[model samples]
Target chain A: MDQFTLNLIVVGATFALYFGIAIWARAGSTAEFYAAGGGVHPIANGMATGADWMSAASFISMAGIIAFGGYDTSAYLMGWTGGYVLLAMLLAPYLRKFGKFTVPEFVGDRFYSGTARVIAVICLLIISITYVIGQMSGVGVAFSRFLEVSNDTGLYIGAAVVFAYAVLGGMKGITYTQVAQYVVLIIAYTIPAIFISLNLTGNPIPGLGLFSNDTASGVPLLTTLNGMLADLGFASYTEQHDTTLNMFLFTMSLMIGTAGLPHVIVRFFTVPKVADARSSAGWALVFIALLYLTAPAVGAMARINLINTMYPNGVKETPVARADVPDWVANWEKTGLLKFDDKNGDGLINYTSSAETNELDVNKDIIVLANPEIAQLPSWVIALVAAGGLAAALSTAAGLLMAISSAVSHDLIKGQLNPGISEKGELLAARVSMAVAIGVATWLGLNPPGFAAQTVALAFGLAASSIFPVLMMGIFSKRINSKGAISGMLVGLIFTVVYIFLHKGWFFIASTASYSDSAPMLFGIKSTAIGSIGALLNFAVAFIVSNATEDTPAEVQELVESIRIPKGAGAATGH
Target chain B: MADKSSSNAYWKANIRAIQIFLVIWFVCSFGFGILLRPMLAGIKIGGTDLGFWFAQQGSILVFLVIIFAYAAKMNKLDREHGVEE
Candidate 1:
């Protein structure tokens, strides 16, 4: 069969499975809709969280970034995975024990102020919306490439499919579907990796294969790669190029942001017990690591393969003829992502950093998607990768939409605006909110600001600066007053957003950015690394305000004490 | 009164475990993976140095172990303090 037909069959089958699970696990009540009836097993919840956490960026873009950026991108790997440690240790168990429905609800109740909750709702919406836009565009790109449709049409189909499952199942339906997605995505990611690993290193395991000697060269893969890159005037693969300070700050921002993301935080609320919440984070990381550990190996090996294919006679020798460029380059050229220009009219492809002589410009996003094709892998493997990318995009989109809907229906409307709203009314509101959110996300996805992974990083930075500090203070420090929390959140949110807008353009208009991501750093920190500094400012401001004004109320102090002790953590229950 | 003291003790034990694990967490990712990476440059693993391994693979593996360790140890403490749910 043709590659397109095989992709359609595999992708169509996966969508059918998701829809079937959605109908079977359809949520019936407010409890079911908001928290999956709070009955999910620890392991099952962990699997779902894994799907929620690993978005399209992880599946499609991360390896590509690592492939080109070399050691500098290790910050992403460490930053993302290291975050669950902070979450499991500091946040998950305590939040689960609080036994509330949404994050804003905890903030409102813990601080004894409705205003605090409203601010939290605003933060949740901002972060979740920004995060969802990336997923939406990811869905569009996956569909466009695999199904041979326009990007906009692919986006609409992706949005409609997500709407069906998310609206029907709520958290309940989404959870089970996410578990299935985790399985599909992990298999899709690992299979091609194993094949490519064996081809390059004679080892079946990709993770170990990364360290093994290359079969063709009989030298360590990294040693060969570093030598080849240096010969071509590129940086060494094994060395760090980013400033250490920037790497530390960027990694810290991602860690805090991961812990603070509302979608992932809400998943813990579904587990049966606080202990389960703790264990669930561990299991989730284990599942996530299955992909992460393989990513570097996949990236390094893919780079080697591409380099070898391009320079069959080696880089020090003559350049390959333009007419001889492979099908993969031609396939990507149509999308304008991969460009080749014979500047000297020599009709040969020369890839180098030098602007005057460079002949090919490869978009970083294309590397992972084109890897299987570059290696001459079978059609089924390519088809599976398409299905996996869609699964990653859709699962994360569903999780983000769930967070947005719950924040609207449960936190905003029911909690503050209409305290007398009926349970049935709230459930209806949640579904309607989800539909509207998907619509807006799809519209914005048609013209995304940056690549899927870069836009997703902005969401993390926003979360790191705003939501994380407030949530951490609410649980860890009893002395922090509502006034302090509010001030800290506003300051952090505003400062971080302004910094990003200045560099990323006001609302990402591209023409408006005064500075690029590199150079003119704030104290030698890039915009991405500024989130950690914003978090620090938040903590400092919150503490200064709390000490200068009033301490936490007496009853609130007792609430803090109760959350600290985990004795009475009943099995998960809806509010 | 006795029950109150025991619960307080349990909370303290929980906090202590978190503290210990967090220290380990920082050491693995931020320490060995980033700051102390240059120091470990002398120790080669496979094709790269020890620091590169920590950054990509070692830290994540350690993070997994830390969480499970915290969970198991905390549950044991909970049972010991008569606070298990």
Candidate 2:
């Protein structure tokens, strides 16, 4: 069958499988809807968390980012994983012990004020919705490319499939479906990487292959990559190209952001006990590490392969003719991910830097998606990648939708607005909220306010500044009070938001509006890296605010004390 | 019993352990790879400096060690607290 047809069949079958599972495992209780009855085994919950955490960026864009950005981008590899340690130590077990239905619900109760809950809910909504739109866009992009449909048509199809899987099953269905997605995404990511790894370094493992020698050049792949990149007017591939301070801050930002994300935190709630919460995080890291560890290898090898393809005579050979370029080029060209203008009209594709800062601005998004084709791999592999990209996007979008809906129903509508709402009524409200969220996400994806990468970074920034500090202090320190938490989040949130807006926009300041991400950040720290600084400010502010105000209430002090110890954890569930 | 108590006390001593390891991890990844990189510019490792190693591989390896250590230590703490499952 044709590659497009094969893609439709494979992706379609996977969706059908997920849809079937959703139908078979439809939730029957409010408990099941929110936390999958809190009965999920640690391993199952871990796998589900992996699927939720990976998202479209991890599956589709990460390797590409690593490929082009080189060693400097290892921040992504480490920062994303490193946050789990923080989550495990300072956040997860305590939250599990507090054991509420939602993150904002815990915030509302712990702070003992509806205002705190409402503020927390707004933050949750902003972060979750922004993150979800990118996932929707990924779904549309993948579908249009592999299924030969228009982008809008593909988005609607993706939305419908996700609705079928998520609305009926809620948390229960989404969890298992995510577990399946993790398996699919990992397989799709790895198979191509393994093939490319063996071809380049004569090594089977992509992670190790990065450090091993390139058989073609008889030099280590990283060393060869660095040399080739430097020759092309780019920074050395394995060198510290960016400022060390910014790199440190950026990595720290992403780590805290990972810990604070509501959707990721909610996944831990589905597991049974405090220990399960801890173990599940460990397992989630194990599963997530599989992708993260492979990513650098994939990026390095892909970079090497792309260079080899363009410079058949090793940086001196004439590039292949644009028109007669291979079928792989033709296929990706349709997706607008790979293009050729023949600026010099010599017909030979001049893929080199223009010798004056490379006016060729290739979007980094296409790197991982186009990896197989760059290496001249088969059509089926390309189609499978398309499916994998959809799996990543759809899985994350579903989880974000759950967080949003829960915020609306559990935190806003029922918890504060109508405390006496019946379980049946609450469940209905959740479904409606989910439907509305999906509609908004779909619309936003179609018209994306900014680039997908920028939007994801903003989501991380907001979470890092606003949510991480509150959650950590809520668990680790008994001194922090409502006033402290609120003031801290406000200061951190405003600082990070204003900094990002100063660079990104007044509100996601656009590049077209005479702003730049490279605008002189404080201490030469870029706007993106300042999120971690914002988090530190948040912690400091919380402490200062608490001491300046009244001591925490006796009940609140007792609550904090109890959450620290492991016993009575399951019973501490404020059911 | 002595061995178990020693392990338990080691586990309970949290500030020192987390502080020591986190400092090392931070120094390797953020400090060496990023901050002091200019200072370590001439110290080469496979055609690059120690800073470059931290950015690409050294920092990541250290992060892995930190997490595994944390997990191991926490597990021991649980047993000592008589909270082992």
Candidate 3:
């Protein structure tokens, strides 16, 4: 059978599985719609969170980013995973005990302020919407490449699939479907890494293979890679190039941001108990670590493979003739993601760090998707990658959509707009809002904003600076009044947005930026790393404002005390 | 139900434990991985040093252990405080 048939069959089979899970898990009530009826097993919730957390970026682009950035990019690895530590210890258990349908519900009730909730809803919407656009675009890219369709058609199909599951089943359906997605994405990610690891280091476990000896060079894999990169005028693979302060602050920002993300935090509310929330976080990390641990190995090995492919004999020897290049090169070249130019008219492709002399131009994003082909793996594996990328994108898009809809239907419409709305009416509203969210995400994805590439910084910066600090202060300190919470969130939100806009363009218009990232304005900290400072400002402002104001209400103090204990979580409270 | 005093103690104990674990978390990821990396570069692992290992794989593994261990300890504390459901 042809590759296209195999691609269709594999991708079709996965879609069928997701649809089956969605059909089986149709939600009937608001509780089921928002928090999976408040009875999800810890391990299942963990798996679902893993799938939700690891987006198309993690599956498709992370290894490539690490591959090219080398040691300077360890921030991505540590920052992403280390946040679960913050979640497990500082936030998850307490939030689970609070037992609310949405993050804004918790914020509103905890602070005893509608304004606080509204601010949270706004922050959640901005963060989730910006994040979801990337996932939608990823879905489009995967579909266009594998199914041979236009990007718009791919996005529409992706939006339709997400709409069907997310609207019909809500969080319950998304939770189960995400579990299946986790399995598909992890297996698809690991198999190629395992094959490559064995080929490179004679070790089957990719994580261990990274530290093991290179089978060809009889040295540590990293050592061999570092040597080759240095010889090619590239920075050493294992040496740090970025400043220490920026790395520290960047990692801190990502950690807090991960914990603050409403989509991730809401996953904890699905578990039955607070203790489950804690262990479930551990389980989620274990699953996430499975992919993360393999990523560096895949990255280092891919760099080596690319170098070897370019210099068939050795780096010092004659480069391969352009006409004699591998079929994988030709295949990828058609997509415009990889290009070969005979710069000196010698017809030999020169891959190097020097821009002027380089004859091969490669997009780092293609590293993971093209790995199997580059390594000469079978067509079935390539097809599985296509399915895996879709699963990663769809699962995250669904999770973000759930967060968006719940904030609108539960927090905004039910909590504020119409407190008397019936549960059935609320459910209908949730479905409608979910469909609308998906539609908006698809449209934004089709016509991605100028700042689409920097959405990560924006989403993380907002979450870290605004949402996380407020949530932490809400749970950890009873002195903080509604006024303090509102001001802190606004201050953090405004500071972060302005800082990012100043560096990235005013409202990301590209021409209105007051400063450039190459030369940052404050303490040598780039805008992406400014969230840590912004979070500090939030905490400080909250402390001062709350101290200056009257103490929290006695009832609100009791509410805070109640969330501290895990004894009476009961069922998640609805409006 | 536990009295208010003992419940407050349970909360205090939880805070203390979280503080200790967070210190360890900070040390592993930020300290060993970044700030103190140059100081610890003398200790080699594979082709890199202890700091690089911490930045890449070691700190992640430590994070896993810290989370599970904290959970177990918190669960036991919950039971001891008579707060477990």
Candidate 4:
């Protein structure tokens, strides 16, 4: 069968599986809807969190980012994975012990303020909504490339698919579906890596294959990669290009942001026990590491493969004629993601990072999606990749949609505005909020703020600056009053948003920024890395404000004490 | 009975464990991976420097070990303090 037909079949099969799980595990109560009745096994929850956490950016674009950025991109790997250490040890168990349905509930009850709850709900919405936009656009890109649909139609379809399952299943449905997604995505990701690895290095394991000798070049993969990069006037693959300070802060921000993201944190609540929450984080990291470990290898190998394909006779030889450019380049050219210009009128491709001599301007997003095709892998593997991309985008979109809707319904409406609302009423509100959130996200996806990975990084920045510090202080410091927590969140959120807007454009409007990351940075910190500074400011503001205000009530201190001990942890079903 | 003083001790012990693990986490990802990467450049692992390996793979491996260790150790601590759920 044709490749498109095969892709449809595989992607369709996965969707059918998700919908089936959604139907089977339809949520019956608020407990089931919010926390999957807290009955999920540690391993199962781990797998689900893996799928939930590894969003479209991780699956579709991360390797591509690493491929181009080289060692500078390691921040993403270390930052994201290391955050789970923070989660497992610092946050997850205590939050699970708090035994609430939503993150805002914990924030509000712990702070003993309705205003804090509302603020927490707003912050959750912002983070989740910003996050889901990336997922929606990711689905759009995957569909536009694979299924041959327009970006708009693809986004709508993705939103609809997520709405059907997420609204029907809630956390219970999302939990099982995410587990299935993890399996499908991991298989899809690793298979292509394995094939390419074997073809390039004669090693089956991509991670091991990365360090092994390149059979084609008769040298270490990294050595060959650096040599080729030098020949093309690009930075060496092993060398760091980004400023050390920016890299440090960016990595730190991403780490804290990963811990702060509401969707990932909410997944811990689905487990059966506080102990389960701890172990589940470990298991989740194990599952995540399978992909994270493979990513660097995939990035390094794909970079080498692309260069090899371009310079078939080696970097010293004349470049391939523009007419002889591969079919993958031709296909990507139609999408405007791959542009070739014979600047010197040589009619030959001289691919270089230098603007003057550069022939190919390749969008980083295309590297992973087109890697299989570029490597001449079989049609089935290509189809499975399409399925995997959809699984990653859809599963993350579902998770974020759940978080957004719950914050609106459970935290805002039920917890604040209409405390007397019945469970059925709240569930209806949840579904309504999901539909609305998906609609907003779909519209934004149609006009995406930036590349999937870059857009997601902005969401990470917001989470890092705002949510993480407040949550940490709430659990760890009994002295922090509601005023302090609220002030900290506001300061962090405003500072991060303004800093990002200054560089990325005012609310992502193009060409609005006066200064770039290249020079005139705030303390030599790029906007992407500024979130760490904001987080520190948050901590400072909170402490200063807390000390000036009235001390915490004795009862609230007791509540903090109870959470820390983790004894007499109540059921997730309990209010 | 879970007295206030005993619970306080348990919390302090847990804090100590957290502090220790966080130090390792910081050293692996930030220290080895970024700031001190230049210092570790001489040490080679596989095809790359120690810093690159740590940044890409080693830090993640260490994170896994930390989480599991914290969980197991804390669970044991909980039992010892009669705070086990």
Candidate 2 docks with a DockQ of 0.29
lDDT of 1 by residue, A1-575 (tens): 99999999999999999989988999999888888988999999999999999998899888988998888899999999999998998999899888888999989988888999999898889788888888888888888898999999999889888888899999999999999999999999998899899999999999999999989889998898998898888888889888999999999999999999999999999988888989999999999999999999989998888788678799898878888878887898988888988899988888776899888887877777887888788999899989999999899999999999999999888888887888889889999999999888888898775644455557888789888898889888999999898889888888888888777778777798888787634766888888898899889998999889998888998888777767687655545
RMSD of each: 1.6, 3.2, 0.9, 1.6
Clashing pairs in 3: none
Q: Residues A172-215, candidate 4: write the lDDT tens digits.
A: 99999999999999999999899899998999999888888889
Write the number of the candidate with greater lDDT, choosing between 2 and 3. Answer: 3
Per-candidate local distance difference test: 0.88, 0.79, 0.92, 0.88
Which segments of model 2 are wrong by more than 4 Å?
A355-361, A509-515, A571-574, B1-21, B36-54, B57-65, B83-85
lDDT of 4: 0.88
DockQ each candidate and list the results.
Answer: 0.74, 0.29, 0.82, 0.78
- Alpha-carbon error at A242 in model 3, in Å? 0.7
Which scores greater on TM-score, model 2 or model 4? 4
lDDT by residue (tens digit), candidate 3, B32-84? 99999999999988888999888889899999999999999999999999999
lDDT of 3 by residue, A1-575 (tens): 99889999999999999999989999999999999999999999999999999999899999999999988789999999999999998899999988888999989998999999999999999999999999999999999899999999999999888888899999999999999999999999999999999999999999999889999989998988888887889888888887777888999999999999999999999998999999999999999999999998888999989999999998888888898889988888988999987889998998888989999988988999999998899999999999999999999999999999999999999999999999999999999999889889999999998788797899999999999999999999999999899889988999999999999988888888988877888877888898988899899899899999999999999988988998877867684
Sorted into a CAPRI-style docking class, model 4 comes out as medium
